[model samples]
Target chain A: MIISAALLGVIAVILAWPFPLVLARSDWPARSPDVALVLWQTIALSGGMSMIGSLLLYGLVPFGNALPQSVIFLGDSLRSGTLPADTRFTHVLALGAAILLSTHLLLNLFATFVRAERQRRRHYTLIALLSDPLNGQPGMRVIDHPAPVAYCLPGAGHSATVLSKGLLRLLDADQVRAVIAHERAHLVQQHHLVLLAFKSWHSALPWFPIANRAENAVALLVEMIADDRARRDVDDRTLATAIALVGLGQQPEVLAAASDGESDEPWISSPERALVAPRVYRLMNQALPLSRLATMAVFVTAIALALAPAIVLLRA
Target chain B: MLRMANLGVLERLLMDVLWDSPTPLSANDLKDSLMRPGLATKPTKPLATTTVLTVLSRLETKGFVTRDRSVRPHTYTAVMTRATHTAELMHEVLGQVPDRQAALVRFIGGVTPQEADTLRQLLGVATTDNL
Candidate 1:
C-alpha cells in the first residue's frame, strides 16, 4: 500500500541521514589500496545480498494473497456505500503502515538521543573533575582513581580528557602524554560521533551487513587516526615505547588500554597498539609515512560512491 | 577543552536555546519556549523538567554555563559569551588545519561575493583602527 511504502521510505531516510554526515566528518586514516578494494567489494556484496533478500521476501512471498484480501476489504466498504472502494482501503493501509514505521523510527531516535545524553553527562563530569589549567596541555585529565580505566567523552569546545590515577602512576610523563594525545586526537577528529551514529544504525537495523562492517572498520580507523595524531606530537619511538609499556601493564578492566592481554579477544584489541609493541620490542620503530595522494583518492571515491545512489534516486 | 563531539543534537539545541536568550531562564521556561515554536507537527512529547535540569547541571559541570542557586529556582548563565566561544572554536579549528591560509582561502571561496566584500570592508576598518 502507498501508506506502508511512504512510512518505510521515511524511516529509511531518517536512518540514512547519519551515515552521510559521518562519512563527511570522519577524519580516519586514508584507506590503503587493499583496504579500499576490500571496502568496495564488501559494500557491493552486501548491497547485492540485501537486494536479493528483499526480492525473495517481498516479491515471491504471499503478495497475491494480500492483494485479494485488500480487494475484499475494499468491496465490503464499497457495498456499505460509505466510502470509495479504491481510496479508502488503500489509504487506511497506507496510514497504518506510516504510523507503524514512524513509531519505530521515533523510538530508535529517542533511545539514541538518551544514550548520547548520558554519555555527554559522564564526559562533562569527568571534565569538571580533571580540569587543571596549570598543566597547560590540550589533552585529557589523568585522575587518581583507584581502578584502571580508560574512556573518552566528547565535548563541544575544549573537550576534557580523563585517565585514572592508576594510569598516571603506571606510566612516565612522556608515556602519559602519548596516551593523552591519542585520546585528544579522537576528540579533535570527532570519531566518537561516528561510533555513536553507527551504533544507532546497528540498533535500528541489526540485519544490515554494512552496518556491522562499517562499525568494525570505523573502530580500527579511529585508533589509527588517533595514533597518527599522537605521533605528530611525540616521537615514533617514544610513542611505540609508551604503547608497549601500557600494553605490558595490562589492567584487567580497562577496555581502551592498548594491550592484547587486556582484552579476551586478540582480534578485537587495538590494532595501533599491536603494531607498536612488536616494533618497540625490537627497537626498530619508525614513523609511518602517510600518502596524501592516496588519502585524497580514497576520500574522493567514497564521496562519489555515497552520492551516486542519491543522485539516481533524485533523478528517478 | 570540551569537545562538542560528545554532545547530542538535542543537547546542542538546548544549549543554543539558552545561549540565544537575553536573560537567565528556568527549565520550565526553556521547555515552554522550545515547545512554543512548533517547529515539528509530529505530536510533541513534553520534555520533563528533570531532563532540562539534568542537561543544565551537565552543562554547568562542563564549564559552558554557571548555575545561580541563590534564587528559589536555579537560573543558569552561559559562562562564555557567544562571540568568545565562537572565536575559541574558530581558533581551535584553524589550528588543527594543516595549512591555515589554504583552509581559510577554501572557506572564503565558498562565501557569496557580497559577503566576501563585506568581510573585506570589515577587515579594512579593523586594520585601519588596529582593533
Candidate 2:
C-alpha cells in the first residue's frame, strides 16, 4: 500500500508540474523563434505521450492473472471475503485500463525518438559541410539552393553550419560574418544537447506544461546568448543589418541555419505584428539594460524553485 | 591577408610562422620550422608538398594571405596585420550569438572564477581590484 501510494504520488507530480512552469516562464524573455518553437513542441509531445501511457496501463489490468502480485493480493482478499467479489472486479478493471493507457503513451514516445533521430541525421549533413575545412574558418558552406534554407549537424571533431546559396547572395560580407558568428556560438554553447534533452522529456510525457515551458525558455535563452556574442564581436549596425536581411528572406526547410520564415505569424493573432516588430527591435536595441538582467535573474531563480520539489522527491 | 574569422587553429599557427619569416619558405622549410624543439612533441611526419599547397590554397580563399606567383617558387604575403585578423575573428565569434549578456552569464557560470576573470579582461570589462 505504501509503495503504491508513493508511486502514484510521484507520477502525479510528474504529470502536473510542467504545465504551470510553461505558463509562468513564457512571459520571460526568450532568445530566438527557433528555440521557442522547439521547446513548445517538446513539451506538447512529452505530456501527450505520458497521458496516453497512463491510459493504456489502466486498460491492460484485466482478463488473466498477468500481474502476479496484483493477482495474489486479489486472491488473498477473496479467500478472506473481506472485500466483495464485485469490488475485486472493479479493481482489476481499473488496473487494466491504466495498463492500456500507459502502453499507448510509451509507444508514442518511442515513435518520437525515431522521428527525431531521422531529422537529426538529415540536418547533420549540412553541419558537416559547414565544419569542413575546405575553405578554413570553421564557417558554413552555402550550397546553391533556390529556396532559403538553413540546417546544423553536431559532429564528432567539429560541427558544421550549412546555408543555402541564395542566403549568401542576399547579404553582404559583414552580414555574412554576423550569421557565421551566430552559428558558431551555438556550437560553442552545445545548445543541441539541451534541445535533445527537452525533446526526449516531451516524448516521455506529452501532457506536461512545465516540460514545454522549460524547453521553450531554454531555447530562447540560448539564442539570446548567441546573439549577445555576435553583438560584442561585430559592429551592432552590421549585425542588425544581417538579422534584418536574413529575417527578411523566406526560411529554408532545413533547420540547421538561422532564418526568419515568411509565414512566421507570431503566436498572438490580434497583435501579430508584434512578432516581427520584436525581431527588428531586438536588432536595433544594442544596449543591454540593467532591468533586463534583473528579470533574467528572477526567472532563473523561479525555474530552480519550480524544479525543486521533483528533485527532492527523486532524492528521497 | 587572411580573415581571422576563417582560419583554423593549425592554419593560424602555420600562418604565424610565415608572417614572422623574412623570406619565402618551401614545404620542407615549413615542416622543419613546425618541429617543436623542447616540448614532448609528436614524431614529425614528412609533410607532402600537396598538403602545403592545400593549406596555402585555403589561406588564399579566406583572403588572409595573398600568393605572389611572380617568383619561380610561389611565395605568400600577409594581407592583413595579425592584430587586425585577431580582432576580426573576435568580432566574428561575438557576432554569432543573439544575446550577449545571457550568453556571457551562462559562460561565466560554467567556468572557474579565474577563467571568468580572464574572459572579462579579454572582453575589456571593468574588473574589481581584488585578486
Candidate 3:
C-alpha cells in the first residue's frame, strides 16, 4: 500500500505538470499531427484513469491491501460505529473527495456530450431549412450568407459541407475548391469526435491546467490535421489564401489582440489566432514529415503512458 | 428525414399551395394540392396524408408555418411570406459569423496583411445580390 501510494503521487505530479509542459514545448507534433493526436488521446485517457486510480488508492490507504479489500473494509467500518484505528480525518476527507471528484468528472462529460449533440442537431435543422444543393456539387450546401463562411457539419451519413454565397464570390475557383477540401477532410476524418472528447475533458476539469492545455492543443492539432488532408489535393498557397480570407472576417476584437503579438493582454482572446500563425507558416514553409522511427517512438511512448497506471494498480 | 434546403421540394410545394390559398390549409388540403398534376416538382405518386402532416409539423417547428387548433379540423398557415423566410435564413446564417464556437469552426484561415485589406473592401452591407 505504501509503495502504491508513493507511485500514485509520482504519477499524479507528472500528469499534472511536467508531462503537459513538455508536450506543449515539443515541436515534433507539428510534423505529424495525426500521430500526435493519437498520443494526445492516450495521454488524456491514461491521465484520467490515473487521476481516479490515485484518489481511490488514497481513500483505501488505511483500510486494506488492495481496492476490493479496502472497499469491504469501508463497508464493515460503516456498519460499526468506528473506522480503522489508522484512519485519520484526512482519509475520510480523501474518500469523500474521491467520490465527489469522480462523480463530477463523469457527470460533466455526459453533460458536455448532450450539449454538443443538441447544438449539432439544431445546426442540422437550421441548415436543412437554409441551405440548397450547390449547383453541381452533390454533398455541398450553399447558404445565402455573405460573411465568406465555409464549414462541414460533421456526422455519419448526414454530414454536409456548407459554404456561404459570399465565400463562393470571394475566392477564385481553386481557392473555393480548397475550402471544400478542407471541410471535407473534417467530415471524412470525423475530427468532431476527437474534438468532442477533448472538449468534454476540458468542461469536466476546466480549472486543471493539463485539461485546459490539452483541449487547446488538440483543437489546433485537429485543424492542422484537416489542413494536411486538404493539402493533399489543393496547393498550399491557395489554401492559405482561402484561410486568410475566411479568418479575416472572424471576430475582429480577437484578431486585434492576436495580431499584436507583443501585447501583454490576457489569453482570453480566442487561441485560434495563435494557432493560425503556425498553420500559415507550415503551409508556406512546407514542413516535412518526421522519420518513421520517430513517429513509432511517439506512439510507443503514448501506449506505455496509458498502460502504466493499470500495470501499477494490478501489481499492487 | 426532414429536408431543409433552398425551399426543399416539399417545403416549396407546401409554401406555394399555402400562398395561393385564401385561408389556412388542412393536411388533406395540402395533400390534395400536392397530388395535383403540374403543381409539385414530383407529383408522380400521391403522398400519404400522414407524410403531409409530418412535413407541416416540421415547417411549424422551423417557423415557416403555423398550426391553428382552435377549429375542428386543425388548419395551418404560412408564418411569413416566402421572401421573408428566405431573407431571415440568410440573416441567421450571417449572425453565426461572430459565434463560430457553436456550429462552424475553422471557417477562416490565416490572413496576410494584403488579404485583410481586400476583405475590408468587401465588408459592405451584404444584400441578397451579393449572395
Candidate 4:
C-alpha cells in the first residue's frame, strides 16, 4: 500500500510539471491540435486525480491494500467518529490536504460557471437592444460600428455570432463568408466548454506556473481546432486572408506596446497580435496531417495516463 | 440562434425613430413610422400597439429610452443619441470579454505596421503562387 502511494505521487509530480512543460515546448501540438487538446485534457484530469489519490492512499494505508476495501473501512470509521489505532499524524495531515485541494478545485469550477453564465446573460441583454439582425444570415447580428469586430456569444440553447459593419465594409463577399465560417466553427464545436475546464484549473492554482502554461497551450489549441474546422468549408488561403485582414488591418486605437529593447516580438504585448502570428504562419504554410501512428500513440498515452492513478491504487 | 435577433432589429428601429424625433412621442407615432415598409430588415406586417408597447418597455428597462406617465397616452423619448451608443461600442471594437474570460471570445490581434507589411507580402506571395 505504501508502494502504491509512492507510485501515485510520482505520477502526479510528472504530470504536473515536466510532462506538460515538455509538451508545451514541443511543436507537435501545432500539427494536430485535436490530438494535442485531448492529451492536454487527460493530463489535467489524471494529474489532479493522482495528486489527491496519493494523499488519500497514504491516509488509508492502515485500512487495507485494495482501494474498495480501504475506502469502505475509512467510511465506516468516519461514520463512527473515531480513528483507528494505526493512524498516524502524517495520515491526518495528508487527508486534510487532499480534501482541501479537491474542495478548492470543485468550488472554482462552480464559481467560473456561475460567473460565466451571468456575464453571458448581461451581454445578451445589451446585444438584444443594440444589434440589428442581418437580413440573410440566421444566428448572426450586425452591430453598426466603424471598427471591425466579430465574436461568438456561446450559451446553452442560444448562441450569436456578432459582426460589425466596419468588418463588412472591409471584407469582400468571400472574405465575409470566411470570417463568418470561422466564428460559426467556434460556436458549433462548443469550444467554450473546453475552455471552461482549463479556466477553472488555472483559477484554482494561480500560483503554479505550470497551471498558467497549460491553460495558455490549451487555449491556443482550441483556436487551432476551430481554424481547422473553418478550413473545411473555406479554402486555407481565403481563411488566412480573412484572419490577416481582420487581425492586421486598420484599427481605431491600439495600446502602445511598452518596448524594451530586449524582446523581439512586439505582438506579445497585445493579446490579439499574439494570436495572429502563429495562426497566419500555420495557415500560409500548409500543415501536413499528423501521421496515424503518431495520432494513435497520443491516444494510447492519454488513456493510460487517465487510468494510471486508479490502476495503481486499486491493484498495487 | 437569432430568434431574439429579429426582436433586436425591431428594438433598434424603434430607438432610431425615437432618436430622430424632435420631442417625446406616443406609441402610435412610432408605430405609424414602423408600419411603413422598407425600415431596414424589419417586418412589413402592421404592428400591434401592444407589441410596440412591449418593445418600448424593454428599451425603457435597458435605459435607452424613458417614458413619461403624466399624460393620458404615455410618451417615450430617447435616453441618448445614436452616436453616443455607437461610441460606447467603439471602445470594445475587438469585442470585450469579462475579466477571467469565461467565454471563448476570439480577439483581433493588434498587428504592428511592420508585421502587417510582412503578412501582406506573404499573402501577396501566396496569391502569385496560386496564379
Candidate 5:
C-alpha cells in the first residue's frame, strides 16, 4: 500500500509540476504540435487520475492486507451499510477529502462542457438571425460588421465559416482564401473538442500550473496545427501577410507595428497584438519537420504516461 | 441542415418583407410583397408561393419568424426587430467557448494576457515583462 501510494505521489508530482515547466519551454511542439498535444493530454489525464487515486489509496491503507484488498474491503464495507469502526479520524477525513475532490473535479468538468455547449448553441442562434450567405461561396456567411473578423463555428453538419464585410474589404482575394483555409483547418481537425478537454482541465485544477500551461500550450499548438494545414495550399508568405493585414486592420489603436520591428508587437499588453506577432514570426521562419524517430518517441512516451494511472490501479 | 446565419437570398428578401410589414404576413402575402416593383434586386425568376412557404418555415425554425396559427392562412411575423437582432449578433461575435484564451479554434481575435505571454515566449518574442 505504501509502495503504491508513494508511486502515485511521484507520478502526480511529475505530471503536475516539472513536466509542464519542461514541456512549456521545449520547442518540439512547434515542430510537431499534434504529437506534443498528445503528450500534454497524457500528462493531464494521468496526473488527474493519480492525484485522486493516491488519495483514495491512502484513505484505505489501514483496512485490509494489501492495497487491492483494502480497496475491496472498503467497497464491501460501504455496500454492507456500515463503515469500519476501526477507521481513524484522519483516515475518515482523507477518505472524505478524496471523494469530495473527485466529485468536484468531475462536476466542474461537466459544467465546463455544458457551458461551452450552451454558448455554442446561443452563438449559432445569433449567427442564424443576422448573417447572409456569401454570394458564390458555399458554406460561408457574411456578417455586416465593420471591424475585420473571420471565424468558423464548428459543428458536425452545422458548421459554418463567417467572414465580416470589413474582413473581405480589408484583404485581397488570396488573403481571404488563406483566412478561410485557416478556419477550415479548425473544422476539419476538430480543434474545438481538443480545446474542450484542456479547458475542462484548467477549470478542474484551477490552481495547478500544469493545468494552466496545458490550456495555453494546447490553444497555441492548435493554431500552429491549423497554420500548417493552411500553408499546404497557400504560400507561406501570403499566409503570413494575411495574418498581419488582418491583425493590423482590426486594431487601429496599435498602429506602431508598421514602424517598430515585427517582433515588438509581442511585447504590447493587448492580447490580440501579442498573439499575432508570434504567429507571424513562426510563419516567416517555419520550424523544420520533426524526425520520424522523435515523433515515435513522443508517441511512445505519451502512451506510457497516459496509461500510468490505469497500470497502477490495475496492479493493485 | 438549414443555416441560421448566411440566410439565403430569398430568405433575406422574406425577412425584409416581414420587417417592413406592419401586420403579420401569410405565405401568399410574402410572395406578393417580394414580387412587387422596386423592392431590392429581384431573383432571375419570380418566386413561387411554395418557395415562400419553405423560406418562412425555415425562418420560423431558426427563430427569426414566429407563426400565428389563429388566422386562416397562418400569418408569420418577425420574432425580433431587425435592428436589435443585428446589434446582438454583432456584439456577440465569436468566442463561443466559456474559457478565456481557451478558445483555440477562433481566428482573428485577441487572446487573454496569459495566453499572449505564453505564445510570445514560445515564438521567442520578448514579452513585456522580459523586455
Candidate 6:
C-alpha cells in the first residue's frame, strides 16, 4: 500500500507541474487541437485521481493492506468511535486534506454548472425578446446591435446561432456564411461544455499554475478546432477574412488594455486578444496536420494515462 | 418543442408592437394590432387574445414587460426602448460586461491592431467597403 501511495504521489507531482509546463510550451497542440484536447482531458482526469488517491492511501495505511480492506475498516472504525493504535496524526491530517480537496473540486463543479445554467436562461430570455429571425436563415437569429457580434447559446434541443446586425453590414455574404459556419461548429460540437470543465478547475484552484494554463490553452484549442471545421466549408482566405472582420468590432475598451504589454488585468483578456492572430495565421498558412502514426501514438498515450490510476487502485 | 417555438415568435412580435407604440396597449388592442391589415395578408394565422395574454404575462415575469394594473383589462408596456435594451444586453452577451465572468462561448476575440496589420498583410489588405 505504501509503495503504490508513494508512486501515485510522484505521478501527481509530475502531472501537476513539469508535464503540463512542458506540454504548454510545445507547439504541437497547434497542429492538432483535437488530439491535444484528448490529451488534456486525460491529464486532468489522471492528475486529480493520483492526487487524491495518494493522499487517501497514505492516510488509510494503518487500516488495511489494500484499498477495499482499508475503506471497509475505516467505516468500521467510525461506527465503533475509535482509530487503530497504528494511526498517527499525519494520517488523520492527510485524510482530512484528501476529503476537503475532493469536496472543494466537486462543489465547485456543481456551482459552476448551476451558475452557467442560470446565466444561459437569462440570456435566452433577452435573446427571444430582442432578436428576429434572419431572412431565409433557418437556425440563425439576428440581434439589433452594431458591434459585429456572433455566438451560440447552446441548449439541449433549441440551440441558436445569434449574429448582430452590425456583422451583416460589415462583411459580404461569403464572409457571413463563414462566420455562421464557425458558430455552428461551436454549437454542434458543444465546445462550451469542454470549457465549463476547465472553468471549474480554474475556479477551484485559482493559485495553481497548471489550472490557469490548461484553461487558456483549451480555450484557444477549441477556437482552432472550430476554425478548422469552418474551413472545410469555405476556403481559408474567406474564413480568415470573416474572422478578422468579426474581431474588428468586439470591445473598444480593451483596445487600450490590449496594446499595453504589461498589465495586471485578468490573464484571460490578454490571451483572448492575441487569440485572433494565431487562428488567422493558421488559416492563411495552413500547417500540415500531424500524420496518422503520430495521432495514433498520442491516442494510445492518452488512453494509458487515463487508465493508469484505475489500474493502480484496483490491483489486489 | 413546437409550442415553445411558437411562444418565442409571439413574444418577439408582441414586443415589437409594444415598442412601436407611444402608450401602453391592452391585451385586445395588442391582438388587434398584431392581426392588423398588412400582416393579416400573410399565411400565418393571427394569434388569439388568450395566447397573447399568456405570452405577455410570461414576459412580465421575466421582467421584459411592465403591467399597468391601474387600467381595466390591465394594459402592458415594454420596459424600455428596443435600442437601449439591445445595447445593454449586447454589452454583457459579448462579455464586455463588468466583472467579466462570461459563461457563453464568444465566437471571436478582440484583436490587437498589430495582429490586424499582420492578418491584412497575409490576406492582401482586402479591406471591404465597411472598413
Best by lDDT: 6
The residue-by-residue lDDT of candidate 5 on A95-129, one tens digit each, is 78889988988898788777766767666656665
Chain A TM-scores of all predicted models: 0.57, 0.55, 0.89, 0.90, 0.89, 0.93
lDDT of 5 at B117: 43
| Index of the highest-TM-score prediction | 6
lDDT of 5 at A242: 73
Q: Please write out the lDDT profile of model 2 over residues A1-316, one tens digit for every residue.
A: 2233244345445545755465435533443334344434444444444343333333323322233454565567668876533444645555565666567555755665566555444334222322234255454454434323344444445356655565577777776677677777877767666656555565555685565555545555555666667777787656655554444343222212332232232211111112222333465554344365665665565454445433433332
Tens digits of lDDT, candidate 1, A1-316? 3333333344344334454335434433332323343333334323333222222223212222243454465457558865542344444554455455446655875777666666465545434433332265554454433323344556565466656555567667886777777777767667665555555656666786556655555554555557667768886556655554444333222322433233233222222222222223232334334377766666676565545434333322
lDDT of 4 by residue, A95-183 (tens): 88999999999999999988888877766666666777788576788877655667888998768888888788878788788777777
At residue A17, what lDDT does model 3 achieve? 80
lDDT of 2 at A62: 35
State every prediction's TM-score relative to the real structure: 0.45, 0.44, 0.79, 0.84, 0.78, 0.90
lDDT of 3 by residue, A1-316 (tens): 6577668668777877898779878987888888888888988877777777777787788999887788888898899967888888877887787788889888877776677677666677667655778976777898765446677777655778888776788788988888888888888787878887787788777788888788878878888888898898888877776676666754445433432443223223233335555666677678998899998898889888888888878766
Residue-pair clashes per candidate = 16, 72, 5, 2, 4, 0
Cα RMSD over interface residues, candidate 5 = 7.3
Off by over 4 Å in 6: A251-273, B40-48, B98-102, B112-114, B123-131
For all candidates in order, the CA lDDT equals 0.48, 0.47, 0.71, 0.77, 0.73, 0.81
Better of 1 and 4 by TM-score: 4
Worst 10 residues of 3 chain A by lDDT: A262-271
Candidate 5 clash pair list: A128-B4, A128-B5, A132-B6, A133-B6
Question: How many pairs of residues collide in model 4?
Answer: 2
Please state what fraction of the native interface contacts candidate 2 reproduces: 0.00
In DockQ terms, which candidate is top? 6
Candidate 4 lDDT score at position A104: 93
* TM-score of candidate 4 on Cα atoms, chains taken together: 0.84
Candidate 6: residue B96 lDDT (0-100): 58
